[model samples]
Target: MGKNYFEDLFEKAFVYIHYDENVESCIFRASCWLKEANELYSSSQWMSSYILYLRVFKLVYIIPQRFRISKNASYYNDLLQIQKNTIQLTERLTTLQKRIAVMHAFTPIELSHVLQLANHHDPSTIFLNIYAHNSSKEYSFSSGTVFLDASFIQNNSLDAIRTVIKTPHQAHIKTAICYSCDNMLDDANIASKIYLSLLAMGITPRFLDLNSPAKVGKNTISISPVGLTNLGNSCYMNSILQCCFACSPFVSLFIDGQALRSLNQNNPLGTGGKLTTAFTSLSHQVRALQGQGVCSPKDFLANVCSIYSEFDTASQHDAQEFLNFFLDSLHEDLNSSAGKAPLPELTTEQQAAKERLPMSHLANIEWNIYKRRNSSPIADLFFGQLASQIKCLTCQRTSTTFAPFSSLALPIKDTTTSCTLETCISAFSMQEVLQGNNAWHCPKCDVPRDAKKTMSVSRLPSVLIFQLKRFRMIGTTHRKIETSLEFKKRISSGMIVPPSFQSSIYYEPVDYELFAFVNHYGDLENGHYTATVFHNYDWYYCDDAIVQPVTDFKRIYQNFSTAYILFYQKVDAAN
Candidate 1:
């Protein structure tokens, strides 16, 4: 027989009897005996080979009779093949069986005793032989076969089996089965009784794929992130909400009751805290049933539409624009500075002197002034400062001003087929010469002159948002850019610092790790939005009410042309 004859036979048997625990166990035992019979035949041990072949025949024959397998069943054909092969071998070995039995000391009585002892042996010591064709290594039963114990099968410990199958780097495992089987031949009547009991309970066997996601039990609560239901063309809203939920600090503000307490109900700019209450309620609903089910954000959507009537219709809107408006609404609703007196305005000379101060000092002073009027959790979390400098070409005068931004909108170069996030950041900070109608009115030159404008990061936020400018307005229609953009899992502060501030000693080193990102498919007229978020040490793709584990990170990040908005959270430099 060929070396792979039994392997191929068992593979077919497994496909047919996969769902039945009793039949699968019977086939597994038959395959072991057939392999031994073939080895004995190869060694010219006719007596031993005949006895093993009889055992294989009995195992296969009982599967059909004991389980009442019908002719229409898939495994019935494989069982007939087993019986035919066994009968042919028996006929050939019959003449030599008596002659070899007298010459050899391996009697059937002695083999029966050995089988009885093996059946009584401890199951913990039994191990399956796993062959990895790619690695050319055999994994002992400890790594992937621990769940094959009779206790595990009886107790229906599918979670334990799932955990072992999900162990990292086990995808190369080709075959795993017990090398020894003794219980089948020890006491046939007792074994049949046990198989019948298992069938009565409706407990079936399960095959595992090492690369597959963990299966959720009927009664088990899911640990995966919950998905949001899309109400009409609300994918833009759903995608941004998922990204925000992935941010621990941002979600904690609502989940921990901070947002409720900080609600500025009296402020005319807010919804009398109604929007905040609706958002907090939605956050709680998502937290309670994450991974377990999907949540309907209808009430939250109503609150949002109440504030922005443009989102009332079932039409697609820009996700970046939605995110900006959502954050602004939340900031206003929870703004602590609401109803507070406004700060005194600064004089023109005072403002000019403040700008003339060191870049670091000017950034801090401006940030403090901005915070005096816009104190909120949103401002503290997502807000960052940018310094814009306009230098006159005719006169050597540089005017610098600092402004706060919720998100950095980076322009993508249409000339390039592919680019990196660092390249986009560089392009955003690079100097641009304003000319013709776009010329800057230089105060020092007292004329509209061609000047150089440069923008740079003056202050970093706890959460940094990047919106890639992929849509362009050409004539009356908006065209989408399909340039592939590659981004890193972690970015250093050096990549974001402006060229002018690279040597500044006051700048502190920081690192940002990507937590979530939103992707847009199709064109501006008919696009779908989705979000890939990192939650609980794994990445998941969320598209409205559908959520699935992300096994291939490369497909989502590297050279991904659909990535529209990315969310990065601040991390310690030491990390």
Candidate 2:
């Protein structure tokens, strides 16, 4: 037989599986790796099985050391030995499973013994192998092989099934029969007798036929670099999904296995529930994919349209707008706050006085208090604080107010050639004299006065998202800025500090590295959105469902004119 597609990969994994020794803190990851190994082994994918087994072997050995309880050190040591022995036994049995893959010549007694041993280890665990071969048909099984569908299994009946050895019941017998396979060499009379005995024991067997080939190969191509099927005009949702999931923290949240449970436990209503569902599916899909995988945001788009009627139309919408709504929905569900609370009620006179008070004064108090009280996981990680300092030229008094922002909106300079990202950031934090109608109302002066108004980064987020102000309204006509922008791999917080605060660089300087990009192609009225993300140290461009690997970031993105949003992660924070 010719070598299988995964044959070479399997050999590499087998070496690691046999000899691996490393320790890590996360026990959940070890457990998940073991589960993946077992599942792959059962599915007859030896290459995936080999890879996952090695992962489990390394992770399982580390579990004992991960425990910090000094008193239970010996106990953990003993537990490790038990697990090691179990894995060794499993590894030996894996060899047997491979040998039995094309076991047409096996006798009834040998077949029965193999099935009994496999089932003996764990009743719930399934170890599958092809029984016979027929050149004419694609799928061929033994004459009396019982096929079991997953839906037929019930949670309540699990106890009866688990107690098969000590207290065999109808459930146990049926489950075992469903998991069994019998060859043509087995006596028909004996098979009939076995069937009769099972019937006498109140166990009835159900079967579903299989049509797939016996010695099947993996779908290495079709499964990955997945193309998403567009549902109407869902490119907006698609683009957002690509960038969000590609984020390392976001991917870790799901793979570590807490985010889904949190979302499911606190199942919010309407769009929240649907968004949760979509994330749940996305998380699983991301984990399950071996390489680059295809994704579709049809469900996510449907949920968005249901909540916001404007999205129901096929017309394109702003990606940033959709991102805000998506994050807000997630925040409502995943935020640290127990739930949303109404603003405190004020007396008639107090409300009137509040309206009279300068908006910045109220914002300095209420907004800051509110932000501290309701710090969400998303907000805590992604929200940056902006300080608006208004210095009264009349009294030499300065008023500093803060507001939380998810992304920084920077204005692009009208340059023919290329503009640097640093320059755009510098322009954002530039100080301006607010005179005329735009004058600041200083409470110290009790009147509108000319003031130096400057906005600077008070606090930086782990992930910094920058949105370029590309769409400009020019007398009922929206125009797109075609100014080419070039971004470096690393940038300092000094670039975003106001010119007046240039001395601030002497203090601790925050360093941010490029992590993701949202590129807008075409014009303002009609444009397509795509994302280029850095994941697992490689760059991949995701356009809707189609994902293609990119080698050189500078070659593709350097001086790109259509860049809309650039995502950066703090080097220290990312670490």
Candidate 3:
């Protein structure tokens, strides 16, 4: 059968296999169970999912034990009987129950008590044993796998107190009412108090189903929203902010107020106070969501309006342009006076000696003492180096210069034909002839001669940003390049950097995953800006305040939409 068939059977709880089955057969069963557990987890069925998850663990335990025992014998033959003695099924059940209890942070005694009274408990509360292995070699079991690493409950268990009390609408309401009544509160005060408690825990109260009654404290809304109040014609800014929030390293810095605290140093841009505060506040609001749901950037927009007067206007602007300006402003604010500290006073003899030098000599002396430092956090995180190689054809002499780039502005070669992101990138780094007025001035030849020039990456950043030059000046009118471009989920450093240029640098090959991208829907003059950002391990399409969870990969990779800017984060080595 196909994987889907097995998955459907497991999801319906129709698959049944005896515990005494062969090791391979048991493994297949476990795989099916694991799949269902994952599906349930995705749907927020925490309690039932954990029960199935434990069953898989119980089944997989046979693998290690089978290896430890005699290979010639079956797993059941080796572990089930000891000295021709049959191990009771109840004994195996007790062991599994203990492990499950530990995984759920419940006492074995309490679990046994609950298991006996299954009819009395709710459907979700009936956590029962699903599997029991034939293993006689008694070993301690704990949640030792790397799975569920992203769980809010870090101990590889559900919060029993919260799960038991907050699950099912009626029970939740009872708990809320009891707490209020215990405080000697009135009926009028109970609703407000309960609402505040849920809000304090970052939970939104919503109906479990569309047809469900609107009882405030009855149901728990697993997802909370960070409502983004859309400023007029500010979808570009909203999209950028959402994508940036998804960047772990970028978000972590400001989320916990570290970036704000570090801003005590010299500001690069003198008028960056509003921008800095806005971004920091944005981070704080997102972090407050606790990786549960969306957040609004009202404060961020307010701050942006205070600084950039153009953004305050009700006009659609380029996302790439805003990103560049934002990064530059941030860099200036954080590191402006980094290496520009006041110079020490010169002695009378030193001053006299300096006055004797020519103006060109004076300029050279000042340049020698100039210290270079990191521009800003944005540059430090996303900035990369590009080496421009210019070779004079006549003299056969070559020269190289390295410059910093926040993002690559790759020009689309043919507007008529379809292109991939790789093609645009290749065109960008491809060697081209610089002839006539565009010739290079060769120092050795001391003349403006025709030369071959190429650009290649010298240093790769942790985050790679790409700006596709879609709009171009055709004759006198500006037109958009209507080329269908394709991009991959994961791209390697080797794909972009040239082999010859890469050798001299400490070029560690990195795999970057496409996380966020801005899409311009429409022609050059008139288009709406939207963004697709990866949040909580899923792709979300954000068009200002209206955000939708995206499942179709094609929606993210639509070539018709003008993919103005792309963000890629280096894949974790551990993953």
Per-model TM against the reference: 0.60, 0.54, 0.56
Which segments of candidate 3 are over 4 A away from where they belong?
A: 1-227, 268-272, 289-298, 341-371, 415-417, 559-562
lDDT of each: 0.66, 0.56, 0.55
For candidate 1, lDDT tens digit of each residue in 1-575?
A: 23563343233221122222455455655666777768756654544455556556655666676687678877767767767766676565554443332222111222222233346552322223223232323433243343233333334444544443333433433222222132211122322233333233342211121211121111121124787888999999999999988887787788888899999987888778887888889888998884778999999999888877898647889899899888888889988887778678778787666655656556677777788878999998999889998888988577888898999999887865778888889889889999999999987678999999989998878899999999999999999888888667888666786534432323444568898899999998699999998875588899999988888867666524568998998863212
- Shift of residue 420 alpha carbon in model 3, Å: 1.8
The C-alpha stretches of model 1 lying farther than 4 A from their native spots are 1-224, 339-342, 499-506, 558-560
Question: Ten-residue segment with the worst summed lDDT in candidate 2?
Answer: 214-223
Relative to the unseen true structure, what is the Cα RMSD of model 3?
A: 19.5
Alpha carbon lDDT of residue 273, candidate 1?
84
- Model 3 pairs in collision: 226-294, 226-295, 228-296, 268-332, 268-333, 269-332
563 Cα displacement, candidate 3 (Å): 2.0
Tens-digit per-residue lDDT, 1-575, candidate 2: 13462353233232111112223223434555556656656754443455556545544554545444454554556456547654674654456334333221121122333343454553432222223334322222333233322222222244333233223223443322322233321233323333333445565422211211222221111112244556766677677767776666655555565455565334352244566566766656755675555555566566667777787637888888887787767665665554556567777566546544333234445555667445556666687667787888998666665778889999998768788888888899888999999998987788999999888775667788889998889899888888998756777665664323321211224568887778888876588888777764477777776778788766456524467888887753111
- In model 2, the Cα lDDT at residue 231 comes to 73
Error of 2 at 353 (Å): 19
RMSD of every candidate to native, in Å, equals 26.7, 20.0, 19.5
Q: Model 3: per-residue lDDT, tens digit, 1-575?
A: 13363243233221223333445555555656666756654653443454455455544554555545455665545343321221222343343333222222211122222222343443322121111232311211211101111112222223432342243443233212111111111122222333344334344322111111221222121122233556777777776776676676776656556567656344545344567777777666665675455566666776777777778637777778788888767766665346466668777567646544432233334433432545556666888777676788997766655567789999876566667778888989889999999999986699999999988776677889998888888898777776767767788776787654332212334568888888887765567787778764478777776777878878776722457888998863212
lDDT of 3: 0.55
